[model samples]
Structures are given as C-alpha cells and as structure tokens.
Target chain A: MKHLIRKDFLKEGYVFATRAAEIARAAGGHTRPARLASNENPYPPSPKAVKAAADVLPPHANRYPDETNKEFIDALKKRHGDYRFVASVGMDGIIDTVIRTLIADGDQVAVATPTYSYYGLAVQAQGGTTVSVPRKADFSVDPEAFCRDAAGGTKLAFLCTPNNPTGGTTETPETIAAICENYEGILFLDCAYIEFDGTDYRPLMKRYRNLIIGRTMSKAYSLAGLRVGYAFVPEWYEPIYQRAATPPFTLNMVSQAAATAALRDTVHVKKIVSVVQEWRQRFIDECPYPVVPGGANFVMVDVAPP
Target chain B: MSPPRKADDVVTELAQKGGVIVRSCASFPPGLPDHYIRVSIGEPWENEAFIAAITDIYQP
Candidate 1:
C-alpha cells in the first residue's frame, strides 16, 4: 500500500521545529524563549490593521470571499501601479500558482542558487525539474551565465532580489536588461524584500513584458500570520493564468480586509522599514565578523573558522 | 581550543544543554562549513543573553 504513494512525496520528510514554547516548558516553565530563526518581523501588525480584520470577523463568516480581491488589488494598484494582479494566501501560494501555470510535467525551470528552498520544493511537487545556476564565489549571480544556461528548454527563470539567506541583491536593472535581452522565458522575479532596499522596479515592468513580480504582506507589512500576497503579472500572462483555472476565492474575507487596511497605513510601514534599516546598519558596524552587504532587513555574516 | 572532529556536534550540544538556538548553516543548500552558524540578530538584551550563553559554553 505504501508503494502506491508518489515517490517524491515519500522523499520529503517533515522536519520538526525546535519550538521555543516547548523548550521553555521542558526547562520547567522558567521563561519563554525567543524564536528568531524565522525571518519574520519582530513587530506585530498595526492596531488599525488588527481592528480592520476584527471588524470583518463578525457577520462575514457566512459569506464567500471576494475572489477577485478587487479592493486589495485596487489598493496595490493605486500604490504600485495598474498591473494585472492576483492575490493568494502567501508568496508560497503565489509561487505554486505561477509554477503550475507555466510549468508542465518534466519541464525545466532555471533558478540561481543558493536562493530560497521553496522554489525547488514547489518545482519538484509539480513534477518539473530545477536547473540551478550556482552563484559566484562572492555570492553574486552571473546574469550572462544564467542567460546562456536558460537557453536550453527552460520554461521559466526565477530570480530573487535581495536574495534570502545571503542578503545580496542578485539582479540589478542593467543585469535584468541583459537577461531579458538574452533569455527567452518567463521571468518570475520574487521581490519579497523590495521595500527594505527601497528601490522600485515597477518602471522596468513596463519595458519587460516577460516579467512577473511577486510581493508579499508577510515581511514589511507585518502580516505574516495573515498569509496574504499578490503578484503583478504582465497583461499577456493574465489570459494564460485565467485559463489555468486557479482556485477561486484564494484569499478569504478577513485577510483581504486586513491586507487592504495594512496597505492604507503607509506610515506604519515606513516606520518599520526605517527601524529595520537602522538596526541593519548597527549590526554591520558593531558585529565582530565580516558581514555581507545586506540590502534586506536581515544580515548574513561570515562566521567561518577563525 | 576546539576539537578536531565535526564542529556541528558542539553546536548541537550547546542547543541541547545551554538552550541557545542558532541555525547550523549545514541546513541550507551548499551546506556551509561545519563551523558556520547562522545567528538571527535580535533585540539588545535578547542578543546579550545569546552571547552570554555562547560565551559560557565555549570560553569556559
């Protein structure tokens, strides 16, 4: 009976979390330990956003969600721009949808390692293969090398700005232009940390129709618990995504309301970003080890053997 | 000052005994060197506690 299960599913095992609460309980309930392994905002959601979610909690439990996410998407468009946007549970969900929509079984997707592990996991789940182009010794990706490799039957190329774990910006505007000019595949740019760097690539979206940018409420918006994210797909890909039959009402009622409120509260977001930047600088200046130039909220330090 | 074997064992010992929970870089792809540990920066006092715990383990 076990042999009937998918091989890939069997290969994946759930790793247990070293739950801080559990550890505290084991230590005879002395004090709660801080959980910082997850790169989440130490701050909680703004009061206004919390109230907005709370407001919708009553009376709306019976009704179906606004599947279109018009208000949330509209807010994003108003702030960002009028690109065809789709809302999902989180960046993970958005990545899943994009992978499903663009990749076929046995199709190839190009990624620049060592980036997010979720990309590989998602690709494997879809029965697609990942072609990982390793970063240079300095942890910067080579756009020319990636473009050359992606020429061979690659359906999609995934690039992360201010790459996770390493905290280095991989794709600059010039490098992106080079990839766009050379590579003939859909560009899935994960801009999950764009706000931290304070650089807007929205203008370049107009020039590169092959691009689709994924942004999330989890990081800067302090809405990680809410699980809301949106992707700005080019107009050409919108029809394909529509035909792909993404599950309707992907983002529920309360999340949409909360996300909309969070977007409106730009002051809170600005304060959070500035504070993060300040602390990031503090770590760079004060830490004993050599710290990588971090464009995101978190820093990656070199703690190799001394 | 340190053992010649895998330094990962020392990291595991610290977490199990001292309750300091930094990530072993081996968990990430390209599984960094055994000596590398990824410590997520925290608030001032919280970081102080972490540093204190590590110093207690290694410097003793």
Candidate 2:
C-alpha cells in the first residue's frame, strides 16, 4: 500500500502554514488568535464581490461553472489589457499547472532561494530537479546567477516579486528583462503581492514572449477563501497552456462571480492595499528587530539578538 | 540583549503563549537564518498585540 504512493510524495509531504484556529488551540483554547502567519488580508472582500457571489451561488448551485471562464477573463482583460488568460484554483494551482506543462522527468527548474517554497516542491513532485541559486544577503536576486542557473538546461524558472517569506521583490524590472533576454527557458513572474507594491511589470509581458505573469484575488482583494488565480500568458503559449494546463471548469461559478466583481471594484482593492501598506510600514518602523525592507503585506524580521 | 532563540522555538512560544501566529523562516531554504521570522501585517490592534507579545517574550 505504501508503494502505491509516489516516492517523492512519500519523501516530502506538503506543509501548510499554521491556521488561526490552530494557534488558538495551541494557546490553551483561547479564542481570537492574531493570525499573522499566512499573508491573508485581515479584512473581508468587497461588499460588491460578496453580493455578486451570493447572488449567483443560490441560482447556480445546480449548474457546473462555465468552462470557458469568459466573464472572469473578460473582466481581467478589461483591467489587464488583452492577453491570453488562464484562471485556476489559486496561484499555487497555476504554478503546479505550469510546472506540469513544462517539466518532464529529470528536467530542471530554476528558482532563487528564500523565496516561495512551493516552486521547489512542485518541481520535485513532477520528478524534476530544482536548481536553486541563493539570494544575496539582503534577499535580493542576482540576475547573472539566476540566468546562469536557468541556462543550464532548465525548462522553466519561477520568480516571485514581493516574494513570500522574505516579502521583498527579488529582482528589478531591468534584471528581469536581462534574464528574459539571456535565458531560453520559460520565466514565470509571480506577482501575487504586486497590488501591495503597486508595480505594474505587465508591460514586460509585451516585450518577452517567454514570460508569464501570475496574479491572484487572494491578497488585496480579500478573496483568499474563494481561491481565484489567473495569469497573463504569452500569445504563443496560450494554446499550449489551454491544452496542457487548463482543465475544464477549474473555477467554480461562485468564485468566478466573486473574482470578476472584485476585479471590477478597483476601489475596494485599493482600500485594502492602502491599509495593508500602511500597517506593513508601521510594522517595519516599530519592530524592535532589524526588519527586512519589503513592499509586500508582511515583514521579515531578523530576530537574532544583537 | 537576550541570546537568540531558534526560529521554531520563537514561533511555538508566540503561538502557544501569546496566541499570535507568525512564520519561522527556518523552512525557507539556503541562507535564511534560523532566528528570522516572517510576520504578516494585521489590523492596528492586532499588530499592537503582536508587538507587545514578541517584545515581552524577546526581552533581555
């Protein structure tokens, strides 16, 4: 029975972040734990988004979601220009999908260390090797190191802007452009926290045909529970992604509705981003430890005693 | 200043004693120090509570 499972899965299981409820239970069943582990918005989704989802949910309970995902994609296109889009469960799903689409057994994927752990995990799950290059002491990525690794027969590379765990943009736009020009592999730029930083690197999508930029409704839109993620893919790779990555009806009707409405209601998203940005700065300023300067909704503090 | 505590120990203490959940960067590979922790920004009051808790626990 044990042999039935994938060997890699057995060796390395997925580790999730600690939930608020678990924290409360750990603190002797105290209710209302401050959940700052996962970078979830402390606020709720926009009223319009909630209403849009609720309005469609009861009526569409019997029907499967539209496999085309036209409404959400259309709304996204309206916001993010006309680019081929693929919506998935979350950014994690999209990451897995891209890895599966590109990675064959024994293929290599490049990533910068101290970034999102999922890229390595996903690559490993697909029987591919992750070629990791360590970030600088300040957690910034070196374009030369990244490109060097990606050029070594790697099929794909993942770069998270306003990177998770460290909460900083690992590479600058110029560095990203340099990498895209130098490396032949697919470059997946994860902008999951871009809303917090307000940096629109999407223009690079026009410049680089090998680039894919992923975004999510989870962070600033406060739809983490609904799990809507999308990516602006290159026109050439659109059909490839559609055939290899996207399964029919991946996003539910309610989530599609909520995400569509959330996309349209820029005001709500702006408000959430503003609040998170303010608090993030406050945390940096007041934290007693040496905090890493980041543009995301979280701060990474070096808690080592001086 | 107090001696540095392991990130895992700090995370556990914060959750178990202070009811505040933060991420220990020990799991983040390759160069992140064991004493580093990642804390998400929360509401003002929640942030204040976290500061108070970590300050108390991390004090000399």
Candidate 3:
C-alpha cells in the first residue's frame, strides 16, 4: 500500500499549528484558550459581510457556485485595478496550483529559510526540490544570496512579504528588483500580511513580468474561516494560470458573497489592521525576552536556554 | 531570574498551565533557533493574558 503512494507522501505531511480544541484538551479541558499561535485575525468579519453570506445561503443552497467566480473577481478588480486575477479556495490552494503548473518532477523551487513552511511542503508534494537560501541574522533576505542559489535552473522562487512567524517585511523593493533582474525564474511574492505592514508592492508587478503577488481575505479582512485567496498575476501568465487553476467553484457561493462584501467594507479591515499593529508593538515593547522587530501581526521571541 | 527555557518547553508550559497557545519556531527550518517562539498578536485581553502567563512562567 505504501509503494502505491508518492514517495514524498510517505514521509511526514505538513504539520499544522495546534488547534483550539487541542489547546483546550492540553489545558486540562479549559475551553477558552488564548489562541496566539496561528496568526489569525483576532476580530470577526464585518456585519455586512456576514449578512451578505447569510443573504445568499438559503437561495443558493441547492445551486453550484458560479464557475467563473465573476462577482468575486469583479470586486477584486474594483479594489485592485483591472489586473488579471486568480481566486482560489485559499492561498494554499493557489500555491498548489502554481506548483502544479510550473514544477515538473525534479525541478527546483528556490525559497528563503525561516519563512512560510508551506512553500517547501507544496514544492515537495509536486516532487520538486526546494533550494533554500538562509536569510540573514536579522531575518532580512539577501538578494545576491537568493539569486545565486536560484541561479541554476530553478523553476520558481517564493518570498513572503511581512513573512509569517517572523512578522516583518524581509525583502525591500530594491531587493525584489534585484532578485527579479538577476533570477530568471518566476517570483511568487506572498503578500498575505501586507495590509498590516501597509506597504504596496503591487507596483513591482508592472516592472517584473515574472512576479505574482498573492493576497488573502483571511487576516485583515477577518475571513479566515471563509477561505478566500486571490492573486494578481502578470498579464502574460494569465492564460497559463487559467489553465493551471483549480476547478471552478473552488469558492462556494456563500464564500464568494462574503468575500466580495468584505472587500468593499474597508473600514472593518482598517480597524483590524490598526488594532493588530498596536498590539504587535505593545507585545514587542513589553516582552522581557529579546523580540524580533517585525511588521506583521506576530513577533518571534528568543527563549533559548541560558 | 530563572534560566531561559527551550522554545518547546515554554510552549507546552504556556498551553498546559497558562491555557495560552503560541507557535514553537522549531518547525521553521534551516535557520530558526530552538529557543525561538512565534506569538501572534491577539485581542487586548488575550495579548495581556499571554504576556502575564509567559512572564509568570519565565520568572518563576
């Protein structure tokens, strides 16, 4: 039975963060555990967004979601100019789709270390090799090191802005431009936490044909449970993305409605961002341990043994 | 002050005793140290609870 599965699948799968239920069980059945592990928004979606989902549920319960996801795409385009977009179940789904499209077995995808663990997992699932370039001691990416590691026939390079766990923008515009100029492979920038940082890297898309920026409604938009992820793809790669994308109806009708409404409700997103920013600073300022200076909603604390 | 604890031990202590959960950076491969933990910014009360809990554990 094991021989029938892919060799990589035989190895350990991606380890998710401890769930709330697990936390409760660990705490001797304490039900209300403080969840500070997964970097989820500490707020709920806007009332309007919730209402929009509820408004459509009864009528669309028996129907399939729009295959093209027109409403969601239109909302996205309105918010983020008229660039080619690919909406998926979540950013994870988009990553899987990209890996499927670009990586053939034995190809290499370059990644910066101590960033999103999923990029490496996704690459491995595709039977592709992950070429890792370690970030500097400060956790900032070095363009020269990245390009050098990715130089020899890597198919794709994944970078996360305001990177996960570390919670800060590791790469600057100049670093991005340098990587794009030096590395010939496709550059996939995960901007999932960009709203918290408030730096728009979208302009880089205009300059780099190889750049693809991924966004999600999970964090600032408070739609984590809704599973809405989208990406601003380069115009030239739109056709390829369309072909490689997950099957239609990846987002159900309710999710589409909720996400569209959430996109329009910028006030709620702004509030969430501001509050997280404040809390992030407070956590850094007050923590007795040495904390990494970060731009996202989380901070990495060094608790190494003396 | 008590000696600093490993990231995994701190995470376990926090969850089981403090009823607060944070991510151990052990899984972030190739560079992150075993002494590092990632804590997400929670609600005001939740954040305060985390700080209090970790402080108690670290200092005690």
Candidate 4:
C-alpha cells in the first residue's frame, strides 16, 4: 500500500469523534439519546430567533448571504460593546484568515498541549510551526515555563479559557497580560467557553493591542448547527484581519439571525448556564470522580481507580 | 455482594431508562475503576432513578 498521507497529515491520527459516532449509531436501536459529550446546548434557540430566521430566509433566499455579514457584526458589537473590530466566519475560514493575516511562513505559534488539537493543525497548515509547552501535571500551562519558552520564532500565543477537555481556565489576568508583554507576536485568546465560565473578558480586551478573542455561537447559544463564530481583534490589527477575511457579510443567513436573536435573550442564556452549573455542582458533590468546576457549560470529570 | 457489570455496563443501563443518561469517563486512558460512573444531575425523578441503580452496586 502506498503511504499516501501528506507529511504534515502524518502526525494526525486518532479521530476519536469518528469512532464514537460509529459506536453510537450502531448502538442506536435503544431509545433516549442524551449526548453530553459535545458540550452543545441541550435546548433549542429562542422563539424570537426562530421567527427572525423564518422572516428573513424566504425573502433573502434568492441572494447569497451578505458578504460583510453586517447584521451579525452589528449585533455582536451591540452585545460586545464594539463592532468596529469583530470578525465572523466559520471556524476553519476564520482560523485561516487570522493565521494568514498575522503569521509569516515559519513564524512560531506557542500554545499549551493536551490542549485543543485544531490550533496547532491550523498553524501547521499555514506553514507555521507549533511550539508546544506541555501542560503541567495538573493540565495547565506553567506561566513561568511558557514565558521562558516564548522566545525565538514565537510570534503567536494561543490560550483557551476554561480550556477544552481539561475544563479549567487561566487563573489570573496578570499571567496572560505578562505573556502578551513578553512576546511580540499576536496573542489569540480563544474564550469560546467564556460564557460557560461565567466570566467576561470585555475589560481585558483593552489591555493589549495584540490580543484577539475567538468565540463561537455553538456552545452556549444553542446554535452550533448555524456555524456562526466571531473574533474580537485589537483595533490596530483590524485592517489586517479585514483584508485577510472573506467579503464583509459572510455569515450564514439563518445563523446570523439566530445569533442576533440569541444575543437579546440574555435571560435564556442565564437560565441555561445556571441549570448546567447547578447540575455540574450536584454531580461533583455526589460522584466519587474529580470535577474541575468553572463558568463554562461543561465540566470535565475524571474517574480514577481506587 | 455481587458487583455490577463494568462501568460501561452501567452506562448502558442508565441509557436504557428514558431521559436518563450519564457519561462513562472510563473511555479515557487509565479507565475508571470497576465501578466508577460519571452521571449528570437531572430532574428529581431522573436523579433519584440514577441513585437507586447506582447504590444497588455499592460495596459498602
């Protein structure tokens, strides 16, 4: 058999999701499917969102979605306090856009491993190298070590709060700010799960001109199927991001409608987060497993051998 | 006292009950012990049902 894999794709093995989907399908004759693994919204979008989409789709169906996706951007700015710098695209396109804008070929992307796999893969796809400073025993990036390692070719540092899989966040603002001050490259803070953590980073966005936050409408918004995500770029890099991005109005029409409606339904978001958080705490209190509690919608629970 | 089937077996059991399901963390490496189960808290009926089934196999 020819080893047809590209050299870069060689390191990509173990598609756990593919395997799990298969098993779940095979096991599906059973009734009642409760899927908690994907960290998705257990509920549907609000009635207003559903109506908004219904209102727009037929009228706008004849046209491609707004190239600027202006409606979504405007809604984001309204919720986020500034739309002048927000960029929305599906994850892959946005990731590519950001890397394309900020990284030169062979630039360094420093991220914590045992972390989200996609960040490293995206960097590699753009001909950039991933400098992984492995997480400490507790599955957290060691601040001092990451600072020490943030030298040479390292032009970007990515951090996910209430980090994926491990389900914990950076403990302090100072440490993150320090990394930005210490490194000259862009600081990409993926707070996709910030809403789940019950913490808002709106204030921190002002601290560093190089900081960019990548967020999604998936986890908390109950709109993953809609595929709307946004990045809050520091004002200075806004032009670079816009130039690298696709047309201005590019979000999926239905998704944009759903997101805008979701933004207005703050009560829904609060009720869902509170319910999930309560469930998370009760599960932790009763179960023998170790639970890392946080503001995110999902909690990563570890069950150890006695 | 007889031990229950593996944690996988218990997850299988919880899923059988309507609107009742819990995650099986044993899928990850260094899998959970013979009886460790990770169940989410749900409405009163669901939680009570989970407790009833789970407590049935506790060794103590």
Candidate 5:
C-alpha cells in the first residue's frame, strides 16, 4: 500500500476530502461546528444499541468474541431468508473480502463512475483494473451499455442504490436481469441506504445466481460508529468469502449485539427517518439550488455560486 | 463567501455598500437558476440562523 503513496503526498496533507473539509471548516469558521456531510445521520444511536454496546464496555471486556457471529447472522437470516451471511470488520472490510475472494489477479471490476471512490481504490490495490460505466445524464444506470463491455476477466459489477454524489438509483429490474444474464460476474449490489430507497431487490435473489447484496448498520440503522456490515452471498460464493475472510470472534460480538438491537428498535429508527424525510422536504422546498432527488437519509447537492 | 487564503486570491477590493455574496448554481445539474447555493437541510434552529444570515445579507 505504501507503494501507492507518493513522495509529494507528505507535502500534500491527507487528501481523503481534507481539502473540501478544510474549505468548509474555514467558511463555517468554528472549531466544533455542526456538519451534515459524509451521509451520516445527525441523530444519535438508539437506546437499545447504546445499551448493547454499554454491556460490553467494562466487565465483559476481558473476553474474546465468537468468530462466526451466529446470533446476529441468525437475526439477519430470519429477515433475509436462507443466505450465507459473513461478518467482516465493517463495510469496508466486507468490500475488501468480496473483491479478494471473487477477483483473481487482473480480473476486471466495473462500478458506476462518480459513485463511491472506495470500489475503484480497493480494486486497483489488488491489481484489478476498474472499468467505470458512467450513468445517464440523470444518473440512472444504463445496464445495457454498462455490461456490454463486461469482457476480459470482468468478475464483479458493483451497484450502489441511491448512489453517492448523484443520489440517484437504478430501479429497473429488467436491466439488472440483463446484466446478470449476460455477464458471468457477481453483481455486488451495495444497498447501504436501503431504508430510504423507493423499492427493494430482495425478492430478485431467487432469479439471479450471481447477485450478492451488502447491507450496513450505518446510515439508516444509525450504527455508524459500531462498524457492522453483512454481505449475503449466493451459496456458491459463500465458501469463497469464508476462505478469504478472517473471522475475528470478538469483533463479531460487538457488532452482533449492536446490530441485533438496531434491528429490534425499528420504531425509533423510523422516527429518525421521519425527521430526515421532513428535513428533505424542507430542503427541497427552500433550496436555493437545484437539489438532486434522493430517497435516502442524506441529499447530494452541488453549491455553484454566481 | 470565503475570504482569500493563499497569496493568489488577494482581496484588493473592499466590500462596497451594495455588495452581495451571490452563489451561482449554473454549474449544478438540472433545475436551478444561476445564483443557486446548496445548503444542508438542517435542524429548525440551524435553519433559522441560516435564514436570518441570508436575509440580513441580501435584504439589509
């Protein structure tokens, strides 16, 4: 990874959005001011999540965690049907595992451009060339043109719903089917913002054998700090993931309790959702700029001033 | 509007009486006038403060 780091990088500070933040921080002119970037929920974690985390704080701190994440996976499986659920350190790690397990060296991975930067960066780190299929003018996925070039060792195609920066979604199931049918690679549909989406793709699991879905306990669940995410791989791909993953038992314990409690406290989560929705409406109405349409908790906006 | 930080953007001209901080949104994709500024959808009090600040800046 240090090979990726450049000599001039030290001269330039950490470039993971530090410039934009510094600009915003300077404009806002406060050390500890409010921020609404990074697609985070302004609200705090739920009571159940708080208590669950609290339980492991002091007395139970001495124990190593259970490796398989049975209780949490059990809860998830109940909601999501029979799928092999593997827990990673977090969503980032899960993405890492997914790419490593599925992608052989020099395997092609395609993702939507101007979408999440992590997909490209991660793939590139593993000697895979990331082909970006740009979205339409309105930012919807063109499944035909996208999968048309799915050749030469293309192993994974990532789909981000209510996609980042654009805040648009690809809801056309027919197109998704076409992509899966034509391309032999696994479709890694990352639905981190599913709670705010206009629809669900869970039922389509039966149709596409190559489809793999990712869910996070972050935004909608408000468990960002807990760092829990799960990927439901097809039975064929399950062994592949398990083989590549480091199933740290203790990490599973923390996420298991936090995620289960988050799942249970749906009502509270809904309340926070309602508030964000209200703010969404208010933002749209009062917007001085043309706000991009999105169903998720956060809005992607461009501030162009005359 | 942000004040000049680097040496390149030295603010030579002072803010005259009718000077307005206009945010252009011509670059924003779809459905906005040229003078569009994107503000986050904030809490009520935060919204109020933003409203007050903009109102004071433009209307005053």
Candidate 6:
C-alpha cells in the first residue's frame, strides 16, 4: 500500500465543545437543548443587520462574491485607520491565513498554554512546531517565559487575551510590547473577545509593526453564523499576505452586507455587551462554586467533583 | 454509602436521569482532571435545573 497522507494529520484529533443536542439525542431524551457549549452571543443580530442580509440574499446569490471585498475592507479601514486589513470567513480562517502567510515547514510558533487550542492546532496543520509556554497559575502569560521560547527558528507567536475557557485575566500591553521587542518573529494577538475585555490594542499596533491584531464579529456582535472576521496587518505585510493568500471572495455578499450593517449599529452591540457583562458578574456572584473572574461574555465556573 | 463518583458518571447520570446536559472537562488537554465539568451560564430556570440535578446526584 502506498504511504500517502501526512502521518501527523492522522495522529491529530478534532476535540471541540460537544453540542448538548448531540448528547441529548444519544441519551434519547426529549428535552429542548439549551446551547451553551460554544461561546456564542446569546442574542440574535440587530434588526438592521437582519434587514441588510435579507436585502442582499436574493439578487446576489447567483454571482461570485466580490473578490476584492472593497466595501467591507473600506469600512474596516475607517474603523482601524491607516492599518491594512483582511476580512475573511471567520476568525479561525483569519488565523489560518496568517499561519499560511508566515510559517514554512519546521518554523516555530510560540503559544501560551490553556489559551485557544486552535492556534497551536493550526500551526501544526501547516507543518510548524508549536512551542507551548505555560501561563501563570492564574492563566496570565509570563512574558519572559514566552519570549524565552521565542528564541531561534520561532517565526510566529500567538497571545489570546482574556483567553477562552479561562475567561479571566489578560496580557498587559507592556507585556505584549515586551514579547514583540524580544522575539524577532511575528506576533499574532487574537482579540476575538476584545469587546468583552475592553482593551484597545490599536495603539500598541502603531508601536510594533510585527504585531497583527485579529478580531471577529462572532462574539460580541451576535454574528457568528455570518462568519465575518477581519485582521489589522502591518502595511508592509499586507501585499505579502495578499500574495501568499487565496483570492479575496472568501466572504459571500450577504455576509459582507450584514457585517457592514452590524459595524454601523454600535448601539446594538453596546446593549448586548452591557447585558452580557452584567450577567457574567451576576453569575459569578450567585454561583456556589468558585468561578474565575471573567472579563469576557462567559464566566468559567468550576464544578465540584462528584 | 457509595464512594464519590467521577465527572463522567455525573455527566452521564445528569443526562440520562435528569434530562440535563453539561460538559465534561476531562478531554480539555494538556491534561485537566476528571473532577471538573464546565456549565455554560444560561437563563435562570435552566441554571436552576442544572443545580437541581447536581444537588440530587451529590446529595444522594
């Protein structure tokens, strides 16, 4: 038999949050499942967003989406100001694009552990080795430890602030700049939950060109189904990213329209954020078990052993 | 009295016996313990249901 597919790919496992419905169906229970597994916005998209997507659904379905994605990128530029941007399928896809653009086989990517697992997984899929640095017991990154591993062969690193699952704690801007200053490689700062954390990294982006900030409409904007994510890349790398990337039309017309409309509806997003923030605190206060001090939409509740 | 059960047993019992579903944190790697489970915060009644199920299992 011919030895074909990558051996490592065979060894890799796809482990993500299991759907409650799947478990209920398997158990033969008749309950209407409460979807709490994925960290999705609890509310639906704003009415304006719904109308925007609905308006575009029909007439544009036949044609290929705009490859350039000019209007969407233009909106992003207005928000980001001067930073070159790329909007793609989802935040995960945006990470994949960055990995594809920078990492070559055998290159190294340093990631803080108990952060988002997908960062390391994506790096591995691209044939790059992941240097997993353990965070502090409180789930905050130790800048020194992370930069120490970023020595030689390390071409990229990822920092997930208010990291997923461990919903509390964040990497300080000083720590971020330290990592960027120390590590010669590119640094990808995943801000998928930035709206919840409420820390702006755009200012830091100006100081460090090696830093790339990636965000999504998934978490705070209640547009997870739309799959619109954008990244602020250093201007110099923009052309390089474009050259190394697939042609633009990764987002469909409806998604682009919805995202543009959603971006304009800051009031709706603010309302959703306030509700989530308030409830998260209330959940922590009310929980009998210990809960992490979450800075994001979801709180990490520690359940006791049976 | 029976010895304390594991997270997997608790999760299975909750679904089968109480019609409630929650996540078992056993699979979260870099090696997490079998003692912890993750329950997403939901509506008051939904959370009350989960707490009730857990109380039933542990209290017994």
lDDT of 3 by residue, A1-306 (tens): 778988888887777887533755756855788899888998889999999999999977898889778999999989988688888998988888988989988999999887888998899988899998777778888898889878899989998888877765457788888888998999998988888888777788888898989999898898999999999988988878778876755899999999999999988888888889888888888887778878888899887533
Measured with C-alpha atoms, the lDDT of residue A214 in candidate 2 is: 94
Please give the ranking of all candidate structures by lDDT, highest first, separated by commas: 3, 2, 6, 1, 4, 5
Worst 10 residues of 4 chain A by lDDT: A13-22
Alpha-carbon RMSD to native, per candidate = 2.9, 1.6, 1.8, 4.5, 6.3, 2.7
Tens digit per residue, CA lDDT, model 4, A1-306 = 438855666675323333333344556653444554456677787777788888889888877777666777777777878535554655545666888876767788888655556777788777788887666666556667777776676878877776665665554677677766777777787777777665666666888787787888777777777777788878878777778775556677887787889878888887877777776676557644456554566555443322
- Model 2 DockQ (Cα-based): 0.69
TM-score of each: 0.89, 0.96, 0.96, 0.81, 0.80, 0.90
Better of 4 and 6 by lDDT: 6
Q: In model 4, what is the error at residue B41, expressed in angstroms? A: 8.5
Output the lDDT of residue B54, model 5: 40
DockQ of predicted candidate 4: 0.18
lDDT, candidate 6, at A131? 82
lDDT of 5: 0.63
DockQ, ranked from best to worst: 2, 3, 6, 1, 4, 5
Query: A251, model 5: CA deviation in Å?
Result: 2.8
lDDT of 2 by residue, A1-306 (tens): 998988888775555676434756956855778888888899989999999999998877998889878999999899988778999999988898899889979999988777888898889888999887777777778888888766769889888888888876546788889888998999999989888998777888889988999999999899999999999999988787777765666889999999999999999888888888888887877777778888888999887775
Compare the candidates by DockQ and give the number of the best one: 2
Winning candidate number (lDDT): 3
Model 5 clash pairs are A65-A249, A65-A250, A66-A249, A304-B24, A305-B23, A305-B24, A306-B23, A306-B24
* lDDT, model 3: 0.85
Model 3, C-alpha of A304: deviation from truth (Å)? 2.3
The A-chain TM-scores of all the candidates are 0.93, 0.96, 0.95, 0.89, 0.89, 0.94
**Native-contact fraction for each model?**
0.14, 0.72, 0.77, 0.10, 0.08, 0.27
Model 1 misses residue B24 by how many Å?
2.9
Which docking class does model 1 fall in? acceptable
**Per-chain TM-score (chain B), model 2:** 0.86
